[model samples]
Target: MLIEQILKTKGGDVTIIKADHTLAEAARILDEARIGAVVAMNGDQLAGVLSERDILRQVARHGAYALQMTVENSMTRGVITATPQETIDQCLGRMTDRRIRHLPVLRDGRLAGIISIGDLVKWKIEEHKAEADAMAEYIKGG
Candidate 1:
């Protein structure tokens, strides 16, 4: 399935945080939203992404001081993004290769939505089930 189709089902609402925002603020947003990552923005431009892992790493390295750091300092820059036209399998491969769990989806060079490794895995399982059902029905001559 295409990334666009997934977005259509999931809706393209991405939680964003400013680059200048503190990591503590980003953590609050993530906690309140029950999400794994947030897109860091710089005046409407995509700056990078900040995830739970990034925050945890910072905390491990600098203790409580990490929370005071700017989102830009904790975020993963030069992010590897996915296009709406890409297939789930393609995106999954890229994520696996990069060892990333989240991918920001872009449309026309603008942030559209985000996809998680869990989402792709769920769809893959659903697709397999659908195919198995179809084959079973075919065998039953229905």
Candidate 2:
């Protein structure tokens, strides 16, 4: 399945935060949204990505006060992006190779959507099940 298809299913609305937003505010947004990451936007531009991992990393290294720092300070800049045309398998491989759990999807130079490793895994599992079911039905004659 294509990433675009997944986005269509998952709803591509992206949650965004400003680069200047404090880590505390970022955490609040993440928690409130029940999401793992948020796109850090610099006005209309994609600045970076601030994930739970990023916050934890900073707090671990700098203690709780890290929350006072700007999201840009802890965010993973120059984020690796996935295009809408890529296959789930391809994106899965890239995410695995990079040891990342979340990926932002960019298409037509715009912020499209975000994909989590969980999403890819779920879609893959669903695809496998459908394939198995189809084979079973074929064996039964049809």
Candidate 3:
């Protein structure tokens, strides 16, 4: 399936946090949203992405002081992004190759949405179940 199709089902609302926001603030947003990451924005521009992993790394490296660090300092920059037109397989390949779990979707250099590995995996599972059911029905009819 295409990313656009996934977005249609998942909605395109992206949770955003300012680059200057503290890690503690980012963590709060993530917990409240029940999301693993948030898009870090800089005055309407996409600056980076701050993920749970990123925050954990900071805490590991800096102890409790990491919570005071700005999101920009803990975020993953030069982010790997996806377009709405891309296919699930293509995105899976990219994510697997990069060893990343989330992808920010962009349209005309603007953030449109974001997808997690969980989303892709869920779609895949649903697709397989549908196919299996179809095959079983076909065999019964035959």
Candidate 4:
């Protein structure tokens, strides 16, 4: 399956935050959105990504005061991106190698959507089940 198909099912809504937004604000957005990460934007440009792991790391190093720092301070820079044309299995390999859970999907050099490891795993499992069911039906018919 292609990344585009996953996005079609997951929808194209990306929860974005400004680079200047405080960790406190970022936390609120994460909690309210019930998402693990958000794309950090700088005047319509992709800055980086802020994840629960990023927030926890900052808090571990700087204490509660880290909450006052900007998202740019804690966000992971040089983010690895995925194109709509990428295959699900191929993405799984890259994500595993990089130890990243989130990937920003780009189309035409612009942010299109964001996908998480959970999403890929879920879809992969579904694909496997569908394939197995098809094979079983073929056997029964034969």
Candidate 5:
């Protein structure tokens, strides 16, 4: 299935934060939203992406002081993005190659939605189960 299909099932709401926001604030947003990452936006422009991994990396290097730092400092600038038309396999490949857990979907030069590795894996498992069930039915029918 394509990314658009996934978005349709997963909902198109995207969690975003400003570049100037502090890591502490970002952490709170992530925790409260129960999301893995937040898109950093500078007005209508996409600036970067701040993920839980990025926050952890900063904490490892800078301790508690990292929380006081700006999200822009820890965010992955020039983030890799995906289009709605892209296939799940293609997106999975990109995520694996980049060692990233999240990918923001862009359409018409605007942020559309975000997809996580969890979402891809869930879809794959469901597809597999459906195929297995179909095979069983076919065997019984024959």
Candidate 6:
């Protein structure tokens, strides 16, 4: 299925954090939202992505003082993005190759949605289960 279809099922609400926001603020948002990441926006432009991984890395490297740093300081800048037309397999491949979990979906220079590896895995598992059920039904009918 295409990313657009996944967005339709998952809802297209995009959570964002200002580039100037502190890591502490971003962490609060993530914790409150129960989400792994948030899009870092510089005005209307997509500046980067700030994820839990980034926060963990900062803490590990710089101790608790890292929390005072701005999101732009720890965020993954020049983030890789996907288009709505891209298939799940394509997105999976990109995520695997980049060793990243989240992907921001862009269409016509606008932020469209976001997808995570968990979402793709869920879709794949559901598809596999349906196929197996269909095969079992075919065997019983024959």
List per-candidate RMSD values in Å.
0.9, 0.9, 0.8, 0.6, 0.8, 1.0
Cα shift from native, residue 56, model 2 (Å): 0.9
lDDT of 6: 0.95
Off by over 4 Å in 6: none
lDDT for position 7 in model 5: 95
30-83 in candidate 1: lDDT tens per residue?
A: 999999999998887889999999999999999999999999998999999999
What is the C-alpha lDDT profile of model 5 across 1-142, one tens digit per residue? 8999999989889999999999999999999999999999999898999999999999999999999999989999989999999999999999999999999999998999999999999998988899999999999999
Give the deviation of candidate 3 from the true structure as CA RMSD.
0.8
Identify the leading candidate in terms of lDDT.
3
TM-score of each: 0.97, 0.97, 0.97, 0.98, 0.97, 0.96
Q: After TM-score superposition, what is the CA distance of residue 77 in candidate 6 from its true location, in Å?
A: 0.9
lDDT of 2 by residue, 19-127 (tens): 9999999999999999999999987678999999999999999999999999988899889999999999999999999999889999987889999999999999999
Clashing pairs in 2: none
Error of 3 at 50 (Å): 0.4
Off by over 4 Å in 2: none
Deviation from native of the Cα of residue 37 in model 4, angstroms: 0.4
Clashing pairs in 4: none
Residue-level error in angstroms, candidate 3, position 79: 0.5
Relative to the true structure, candidate 1 reaches a TM of 0.97
Record all residue pairs in model 6 with backbone atoms less than 3 Å apart, i.e. clashing.
none
In Å, residue 53's CA in model 2 sits off its true spot by 1.0
Question: Which TM-score value belongs to model 5?
Answer: 0.97
Model 5 superposed RMSD (Cα): 0.8
